[model samples]
Each structure stands twice: as C-alpha cells, then as structure tokens.
Target: MLINETIITDIKNIIAHSKDKAIKAVDHQRTLMYWHIGERIFEEEQKGKDRADYGTFLIKYLSEQLQPEFGSGFSIRQINLYRQFYRTFTNVHTLYAQLSWSQYKLLLSVNSQDKREFYIAETIKNNWTVRQLERQIHTSLYERLLLSNDKESVLAVAKKEKLPSDAKEIIKDPMFLEFLGLKKESAYYERDLESAIITHLQEFLLELGNGFSFVARQKRIHIEGDEFFVDLVFYNRILQCFVIIEIKTHKLTHQDIGQLQMYVNYYDRTEKLPHENSTIGILFCADKNDAVVKFTLPENQKQIIASQYELYLPTEQQLMAELNKELENFEERDKPKKEIQ
Candidate 1:
C-alpha cells in the first residue's frame, strides 16, 4: 500500500511538471505564430497602395473569421496590433519567448525602437509581467534614463549582461507612488505610506526596478542597548547588498540623512555578509532640498541617495519643467567659479 502511495505521488509530480512544460511550450509557439502572422500582414500592407485602408479592412475581415474559432485572442484590435507588432519588431528572432503577446502589444506603442528594445530586454531579463512592463513604460523609463545618464551609458545599461551597483542607476527619482493610492493633500502620515508599500510589496518591488526582493518591514535592530526600527529593508541580488528605505511624508532634512546613514552603517557592520557589498540607504521623501542633500553627504557619496516621491505620475508638462530646472541647475553648478584673489 505504501509503495502504491509513493508511486501515485511520483505520478502526480510528473503530471504537474509535464503540464507546466507543455503550457510554456504552447505559449512560446503562440508568440512565434503571432510574429509570423504579423510579418505576413506587414508585407501585405507594404504592397497595398492604400496601406492604411487595406490594413484596416484586412484586420476587420480576419477578426470576423477568426474570433469564433480562436476566441478573444483574434479580435480586430489585436489583429491590428499584430500588424503594428511586426512593423515595430521586424527582427522577430530578437523577441524574447518569455514575453507574452500582451507585452508585445505594449512594446508596439513605444515610438522609439531603441526605447522599445530597452524595455523588452529589461522586461525579459527581469522577468517583468505585462502589468509591470506597462507601468514602467507609462512612467517614461526611457526618459528617466535620458535624464540620469548619457546616451551611450543608457544603452549600455539597458543591454548589459548584468545589473549595476546603485539602485539610482535604474530607479527613477520622484517615483510614482500613486499606486499607494494616497491623496495629495490627505495629510497621510509616513507610516501610512510605509504600510501601503508593505501591503503592495510585490508591486512596489516591480516599481523599484530589477533585483529587489523584500527582506523585512519595520525591521528592528539593537545596538549597545539602543533599539531602532528600519521602515523597509530589501536585498538587491544584482547589487549584492542590502537596500534600506526610509519614508518621509515631509521634505527631506539633514536629520533624515543622518538617520539613514546610521541605518546604513548598522546594516553594513552587523547585517551584511562579508561577501556582500556595502548597504545602500534611500530616503523617499515627499520633497527634497537639493542643496541640503548635496551638502549633507560627503563629496563622493554613493551609498546614500535622497529622492523625492510623488503621490501621482507627473504630467508631461511637469516632467519638462523639472527637466528644465535640472538643466538650469547643472549650468549654474558647472559655471566656472570666479578665481578668488
């Protein structure tokens, strides 16, 4: 009887594994099939004198014929998407099998091929879901990269074989925390935001970009009979270090920086393994005094970063204004200081 029970368990495991493999194989095949269909539709559209009109008609006719047989996957809109998909990704071989058709549809909407490729590569490398990919794209990940890095470095980081050391290298400042669903003038406390993040930890991690995994929330540490609580703790596998997040509902202050530095120091000395890199502390504040941030840290500080957090996604105009401000600040900072006699 025991032998029979063991055999049954083994059979069930085999069946589950087989089902998973089969599902993956089907998904892969479906992606390839869609790519091929897209290629064919694109070629036909190119040949048509009135390509736009003809493409619309083709998609409509195809949807009518295929929807009943293939169900929701073959709607007219999706057919149109497939056509655009081919146009966007002419090099079908580069399509990552891990990405679903939904992700490809989102990728198709991005105007820049380089930007699309970057998102695609990152999505595959990080194993981002369709929703996560959409969120990142909507957040203007490409634009953020442009703001933070040179063109060459941006491309390199996007296509690199490995992730970088700093979260700021990938994480966008003024992070869109609208997902927390906090009202702008709600007078919500820091603990409220922290609680939301903990509740939506998975989404938060996705927004945090790649290599982050939850370690703890409100993690307690005792040093020399003094007790302290860290708001959020995460491990970045790529950076090989602990990431300590301190939340502030108000503008950042030098005291906040000092507190975070202490947390980082504690983590580095006690929590971190010998093989791991130094701990990184991030202050997520509703506002940041740039001058305060600049002077509060050492000249070459890399471990601690003070970034503003926004309750909602900024509009294009707001982003542009911020960019202009940053540019002006850069110009001011770079202007040669008058030689002191």
Candidate 2:
C-alpha cells in the first residue's frame, strides 16, 4: 500500500516548524545566559568598591576563560556587550524576550536614554529585524523627528501618549533619501525622482514619518474639463486626511506652491468625507526659499507644507544650523501669541 501524500506532507511540515521553534528557544536561552553573566559581573563589581575600577580587566579575564571552554561566543567585545546590555536595561524583569542578541547589541550603542527607549518601543512594536533597527539608528531617525517637534512631543509620539494632531508633527523637512542611492549632483527629472521614491517606498515612507499609507501614484483629477496629476497621494491614518504630494526637482516657485494648494483644495472640496479633517498638501522640492514660501501661502496656512528633500545625509554642522533656524522660527511664532496674552 502506497503512503498517502497528504500524510507525508503534514509530517514534513511539522518537522520544519519544530526545527524553527527549537532554534528560537536556543536563541532566547543564549540571551538569558548573557544577561545572567552581566548581572553577576555587576554584582561582583558592586561588592568590591575598590575593584570597580577593574571592569576592563574583569571582562577580559572572563572572556579568556569562557572563550576557551565555551567557544568564541565569549569574546572580549561580546562580554562588554553583555555588560552594556545589563546596564542599559537594569531591570532584568523588563528584558524584551523577542529581541535577538544582535538587536540588543545595536540598542546598546544608542547614548541617549530617551532615544534608546524610543527605539526599544519601536522595535518591539514594529517587530523590526536587526537590519531595520540598524538602519533607523544610522539615519538618526529620532533626531530628524525632533526637527519639527519638541523633545516631549517626540517622546509622546514614541510612547503613544499623544497622537499627532497636525501635519507638522508628522512631516519631516530635509528628509534623508540616501537609501534611494541617488547622487547629490545628479540631474534627474521629476519623474525619475518620483520613480526612485516608489522603488524604495518603504524607506521613503519611514523618512516621511508615521501613519502614512500609499494611496496612488500619479493620481489624476479632473477640474472643469482640465486634467491634473498629483505626483503621489497618501493617506495619513493619524491625521485622518489625504496627503497630496507634488515633486519639484528644482527650486520651488510661488507657482509650484499654488499648484499644490489647488490639489489640496480639490481634495478638500470633493474627496474629503465630513468626518475627516482637511487634506494636507506637500510641495516636496529640491530647494525652497523661505521668503517665497511665506509670501506664497496664506499666513494662517496649516495644511500646505513645503519640505526640502536631501539625496544624502546632512553633516552634523549642517543639521545643527537647521535645528537652530527651526528653533528661532518657533520662538518668533510663539512671541506674537505670548505678547497677545
């Protein structure tokens, strides 16, 4: 009698799943083992206050003994990582079980406590792989978010303490697009840039900040027999509105802003449901003149945003200058309100 094919298939599937489960269990146990090592190291250092200065030597000695008996897993670098992992998450009870040892190694490098906490929460929430976590840290995602928002607000966003109430909170200026692999001095058409963004859509959306989902590409609309195409359209779940984007590969003009505003108006008038908020329009340009943007839009404009995109990451000095300028603008905006009060 021939064996049933379905029975054989089911048996093979079960073996594969069991193998995966066993691997996960082994990885988790290894993480626990490292944590215990770190905990013991810390406790020993604490008991002898004078020996606290010997942390460097202590880790080296442990690595020497452990590497020979237990394989190269106990290298000096890894021993230090374990020590850092414990220091970073002091409470053993709060250790994240889902994160691999590799992910913990990355989180240890984040210097800021608040920023590290944000990354931890995001990693767990999104189920990020080791590579994704590395990418977010490398691109300074936290610092970029801080560009348009206060520190507390950024923390709140990370912790889900407060939802984004406006477009500014979610729209990042000078978005980093190095992942697109575009050259800084390359002369590419608007269509080419748009296509590159679509190709690396996930990275582009991450650079765009939170709660955005792609709706359409070159979304077409008809107005009184004339047809216009919006470069990209997205819906912001947090803001409960449509985000219409127009790409300009050159310096932004008043006319460019006007055209984006027209798209915003069209969506607001015809597409938006009564329950949803006003649609937001973004003029994603290669360069924008502040004076031109200020004079082009109404003083009370809140929905239309003009943001510049960068093909590569900005230098630390350049980022600092931009941050200072943003802070100055914030102060100026608050001054009028404070004086009125």
The candidate scoring highest on lDDT is: 2
Q: Point out the worst 10-residue segment of candidate 1 by lDDT.
A: 145-154
- The parts of candidate 1 lying over 4 Å away from their true place are 4-13, 48-76, 158-160, 222-225, 314-341
Q: What TM-score goes with each of the models?
A: 0.82, 0.86
Q: Candidate 2, residues 1-341: lDDT per residue as tens digits?
A: 98778998999999999998888788878888889888899887777768655888888889998999988779998888888778878887777777888888888888889998888877876678899889788767776677667888877877788988878876777677889999998899999999999999997887787788999999989999999999999999889999998999999999998899899999999999999999999988999897899898888779988888889877656766776787787668656555564
C-alpha lDDT of all candidate models, in order: 0.82, 0.85
Off by over 4 Å in 2: 1-25, 51-53, 314-341
| Cα RMSD, each candidate | 3.6, 3.4
Error of 2 at 29 (Å): 3.2
Clashing pairs in 1: none
